[model samples]
Target: MSANTTSFKHVSYLWDEAEAAKLAGDEVALLIYRSNLLGADLRLTNYGGGNTSCKAMAKDPLTGKEVEIMWIKGSGGDIGTLKKSGLAALYVDRLRALRNIYRGIEHEDEMVELFNHCIYDLNSKAPSIDTPLHGFLPFKHIDHLHPDAAIAIAAAKDGEKITQELFGGTIGWVPWQKPGFDLGLQLKECLDKNPGIRGIMLGSHGLFTWGDTAYESYINTLEVIERCADYLEQNYGKKGPVFGGQKVQSLIKADRLSKAAEIAPILRGFCSSERSMVGHFTDDDRVLEFINSNDLDRLAPMGTSCPDHFLRTKISPLVLDLAKDEDLSDVKAVKEKLAPAFDAYRKMYTDYYNTCKHDNSPAIRDANPVIIIYPGVGMFSFSKDKQTARVAAEFYTNAINVMKGAEAVSEYTSLPRQEAFNIEYWLLEEAKLQRMPKPKALSGRVALITGSAGGIGKAIARKFVEEGACVILNDMNAERLAEAAEEFKKDFGKDAYATAELDVTNQPQIEVAMKAAALSFGGVDIIVNNAGLSISKSIEDHSQKDWDLLYDVLVKGQFLVTQAATAVMKKQGMGGDIINIVSKNALVSGPNNAGYGSAKAAQLHLSRLNAAELGADGIRVNVVNPDAVISDSNIWAGGWAEGRAKAYGITVDELPAYYAKRTLLNKIILPADIANACFALTGGLLSKSTGNMINVDGGVAMAFAR
Candidate 1:
């Protein structure tokens, strides 16, 4: 089945009567439940791209009496995971009073402030911009959404006639207007003129449905969307020759683009800004089908599928031509092709901004394309981090589907360019952008940590993320890596990090991981060679296999991953840091630890060599030598702790105390201590230091530098 056909179905009312009965008196609880049901379905709305509201009776703050109030989704909150705090409560009468002063409100900024002033409680969050439209309607519940199927119908040239035909005058149609007090008033007027309508469709915008209860409004939304989906399927489901049987061309498959991995980094580097690292997403089959179509060049640049998407995707995407036979891996070819294309794209963006922006408009956003359409390879989405890029990709992916459905029925149309500009440069959106928190120290940087499932490596990964760096976790254990990624997501957002299951000693896998890091998070800013295994054996008893195993992981693996990462750093023309998590054994060896000490010593020397050779490229190589960090450490697992405890003539539980008392400072070393040293070296705190080994052993005399 086609992508559109697979998702087409009758409306499924997800309301559970038992659950609703439990929340009978709690309108907010019922509202959240129904909102989640609508938001969870991508067919209904994109992430955080819809609003819902319900009118209920609540005690007034000023007067000790109950009054009618409206609880609506707040700005910047996702409906799928919305909570009580995500909905801002407003006094219904106070919000409705804005219509009296609506004629006097001249600026959008004033309108936004007036809406904020209508909050029922002083501590409540700022209500959504569309709250006025929700409050003005006479219904007790309302939902406004940009469903793909509904969008396809609303964006068509004959959208009004289609709405009338499908709903039989049950749905009112309003012409496109910039959303604010004026548009809300227009919607109120439209409903008054057309009595008994179940919903309203904003031209080139989306759908709005209302009823006496949350379930009624939600089902109305679902039924309207299903009707649009059914209309498209019934009228345009058949395949036929259009344009006088010119033999329409098919798009190239993604698998045919062998060099997508290599080209991803180049495109990322080309699109990056001074303050932002450009994360990338290589297209899947659906995207490849859309970008490779015969009508791509014409349809792609016309406009976005929805006006709200213009802020994320821009008015149009940047189009590039990649020949099938070109070697994308070649540095010279990538530079020659991408450099000029990026320059032209920037120029076009500047021209558009200059032509559309008014004196009162906020400053133009950065002149960079959010979406990139490549003819041969596929398409890509660029953003400061992975999550934002994913959201843009999701919207554009849906856009392709909507465009296809619209084209199948009638010509696909978008709001005029000026209308798009009005929303894109609106003061309210600009305020939202300005409200973002300041960038952290390592913002827009990518760090890769080997053996990141536990211990020092994991600690380092967490530190990087805390400082606003996108971390890529690598471990041989896939299960541990997945768990670590999920744990990190709880603190940092899901897009702040990525994971790869990798055996550092595998050369092929090392190369793939390097490319994956670059593709997933633009390019590498830091590389931590922290993956190693410890073995204890006498010199006479140590086998060649044991020695080789240590060397392959501790020495050889570091060399391979570093070499690959350095190449990408060079391509990006950005300096980087290479930190090796060596052991104190490198400086002072213990008995029966020959293999481990020898490999670590070799890695320490290799780091100095890399530092000497790569200094000209601004890449700093440093070493963090830590010793006896047993807490939450994986290296001490599998009888190693017991063996060490036996050697020290102490119980396993007291082994930590024994080591702590041995140091001059009588302090125990922890993984976080080593991580802090690593962070200090790489985060420009010790910018002038390189090829230097910093100790985290709480005063190890034997391991001290001369």
Candidate 2:
């Protein structure tokens, strides 16, 4: 169909000239506003997959002259949340002048170095590799994006003809060229030939739309995409084959959803590197639909929708069939099935790298597959961290949609395997890889911290994040849990932690929290059962309600959380640590504290029992007995600290000093001290110790174990 004859889909344009004029002189503000508007829709751009630029007149810092400056999206920042700092500005004339001295550069490292030398501002962040494309364009506003609908047409076998059919003479067409200075020159030449063209469809790459204003460029992008979407719908929407049929039914012999959860940890372990984390995402509906489809085998082996996704989702996905009648739940059986498949995949990837690599290419990334597909359950995307996994998930999801769209029109085709390899191991991408900070000691580890909103639990959560662990923070207080999550995000990045408001005593809640932890990260590796309370009362004065509450929180709560955490740990087949926050009173009795002390004693014994039972599974259980930790402790707020102070014949202000004097160190125990002991127990520093007690009570003589 031709552009004139095709009825295109209607899209809502988010442009407002009034809003654009509000920040007319401020280029960065205008860019941020328009970038956010375009980025808000995933159909236009996926996470970190697009770049936008504005050519603005600004006073050069060095020479007070009004120069044309190109402000483009910087690397390693999302367009949706882009700030002024996210853009790297360069002098347009100076940047363009590099074309004179630059010969056809073959190596990406040299190209990147040449590009970096063009930076007009030393303080600006590094610009995207596509910055040259933006600089070469004549228009004042330009946007380069990997819109799925646009990519559906761009990735087709007849993509150039498809581009002509959709946009006719208004948009120019450029064949796939590895993005660099030469490609930028080629794009400029294409636009120069078609001076009236409003956009460019980059075969096997993406789309570029440009105009004199941000609104104009954004509207042009939307109109072209809408036209493509409409063309796809008219040609393939009604004619496409229905997804469900006899093949889907045949593949559903056993429950795959449950099976997926069973196999996720195993898959995670196989994909994880010693230094990099491998987070898993198994609950996306698009992933489920794609994996469950009968055409998955045919579609998955096809290359990615665009070369840009190679860095995140890899060139293709790995498919595993878990539909056999054998016991799929057994870890050993799952591992046996996966071992051969993983070996085969690695061999294939290694062969591809060896055959396609050039002298300038970076070292091959780990041959492990980033995305995994199973017949019955769903697909899983893995990465070095949760945020990257989520990004890969989004890209893969969109990739599936693009493939489906392409299949409906015709057959889906990807960039050549050689081209994909070229992009995957390109020097520019390798530079970014090299810039990534070295992984911390606990980089791939996941930890669950109960009562993490405050006190020792919060401190431990902070320590875990600092050591490069993904933490799931749980607290009974909903408000405090949210606050703690915010604080954690502020301290670390948002991907470092997740929060669950949990009442640990309840079995159902505990189970849900455990699943959340598994889904948030891959599986639980370390658990801090720090959620507890205390009631100061004699055996006679401790009422039935008070005694039950103490037991429910201090003793039974640990039991429930431990049971849940251990189930995940066993499935993971990775040894883990479980540290119970008991009390110094557990080892030595104190008057008028029977309810708290007895419950703590029960918890200590529970730890010993767990250590014995779980030793076979490579899970260690230990206790951290902390006393007089009044600073920032919620346990001391419920009239317990005041009551203890009264027993010592002192005020609450003097109680800390009194307790310090009783211990040999004569130092008051702080929350941080307890956190340090917890870290020591679980941080692989004392890996050989289990069923052991570490005291943070300033060295009490009676509490010390013989």
Candidate 3:
């Protein structure tokens, strides 16, 4: 069971000489290299999924003592080729001190401050979320990787059996649990039990390994992978036609390049693999076989190698039978056929969730697969980085191997629906949500705001607090939503506001978050679909993505939240008010604002429709269109209003006046003006007026119809 007696041979390509050298001498270099090594294995780690650490000594500023310190990777840094500057040097003593505090701390801010006070780093990023775990480990050099092979065995249907066979007594296995303090605590116990253990495998997550020397740790990683691969080959021996495809290399190369273009703008700076080894492997039979496997349902219980792999590979890949002579060259045609296949996959996911989830759980995650393969065309994988891509592919590859082996053993079953939901929505796993303090908005009438975390959303949220209504601020940034909630509490006190980090476009999540918010608030009484985004570009410069994103938040998001709120409003029997933060574009014929204008118009209509349908239920809906709101926020801090002012032949200072002059009343509006209007609609002052568009634009009107 000792690391010395483990017979596994090293064959892992997870490290190079540069990394090995860093581990041997410089602790700083070792820390950076170890982080980069973990980052380079994305299939095994992703986005901000993994953590690594190295121990050293720091001269304490206050105590003037040489204190034991652990240099851990700062949060959100890419581990692959990580920089030395990316580390936060925390007092190992402080980290261990926190670990020894058996009484769980109630507030994370207290813990965060304690960490900040002790950790010395020029890096501004937060400490690695796994800092507590690093403190618990005794090794000098610790590495955590989301290795597909290792996680595959750990997440397998007979994961226990597979893990016992591969590492046997050499590794300690912990069942799937939320990472962070809890998992770290469990790991500490496991380590205590297996005192000589060289590594640990977290079920349904990734692998952790460490050693006295860097080479030994890296080599141990290689050895463990080789053992797993060998075990897969021996037990499953899955060979040939793992996938089916022909050499349509030229077509695939062009198609992949075009696909890369679609993703490039969003990914920003990651090195692309448009036609690299990754692209070639995905096109191979092994990947295809993994995707097209018939035993997906039975084997999926093993779980993904890690949760993030779901983002890349989806819950699983889709297998399709394309029609002969289908013109994939016609991009629209290809997209059309691909739609139904993905739809089928999504349907399967829903069925799985419904069958598996318990009554008391949030639903599963985004069902989009990480990889998709076309029989002759090729395969495609998505990730934030190359390491992520490789790790995901490896997971997909080995997941199939495990499933194939399981077919020979017994019926494969995934975690029950409730169990999976628990994992996905574990409070510790849902770090984003747990960080935000509960808003007092939960105690009174409900209020909904669109784009609730950005720009005017934050403003209106503040205003609603002033009006004594508990507000539900909706936004895409779950993290930002948490931060905003803190700000709201600080500004308006704890009872004033709550947030639903709900993507307005995704109706399901919106529904879920809304229901939760309503239940938390007792009932909803107000809604302001203030969620909107604007791209000041002419029609020719507008993209489908831009158009869709604008519409989804402005029109669709508003409509969905309104619908959910109206249902709750009717039951509450108390009158409710919905205010739409429509733009001047909705009333004015403006160039370079086609999408925002059109979506705002739709939003205005949706508002009117709500006014018409729900007015009988004691609910009123209205619109507030602001012409030019001079604000001190980021959106208006730059080229936006300046460009508009220039286009109108005026200086930036004269811009608000120029807009003001167009209105009968030469008044410059603030978000507070719109907020005042929303307050009026929600309060008793405007109960008589429903289905109205109250122009807050100081009498500006480019189109005077209706």
Q: What is the C-alpha lDDT of each candidate?
A: 0.81, 0.80, 0.61
> For model 2, what is the error of residue 368's alpha carbon versus the real structure, in angstroms, after optimal superposition?
2.1
* Clashing pairs in model 2, backbone N/Cα/C closer than 3 A: none
> What would the TM-score be for candidate 2 when compared with the true structure?
0.91
User: Which digits, one per residue and each the tens of the lDDT, describe model 2 over residues 239-279?
Assistant: 54523322443235234444555567777777764344556
Please provide, for model 1 over 396-489, each residue's C-alpha lDDT reduced to its tens digit, 9 standing for 90 to 100.
8878767767776777887677778878988788889899897777777889988988999999999988887888888999999889988998
Clashing pairs in 1: none
List TM-scores for all candidates, in order: 0.93, 0.91, 0.48
Better of 1 and 3 by lDDT: 1
* Regions more than 4 Å wrong, model 1: 1-12, 237-258, 489-493, 638-654, 684-689
Best by TM-score: 1
Pairwise TM-score winner, candidates 1 and 3: 1
Q: Which 10 residues in a row give candidate 1 its minimum summed lDDT?
A: 241-250
Q: Give candidate 2 misplaced runs (Cα > 4 Å).
A: 1-12, 16-18, 61-63, 105-108, 242-246, 249-259, 273-278, 324-328, 359-361, 477-494, 499-501, 543-549, 612-617, 664-666, 684-691
Assess the local accuracy of residue 477 in candidate 2 as a C-alpha lDDT between 0 and 100. 90
Better of 2 and 3 by lDDT: 2
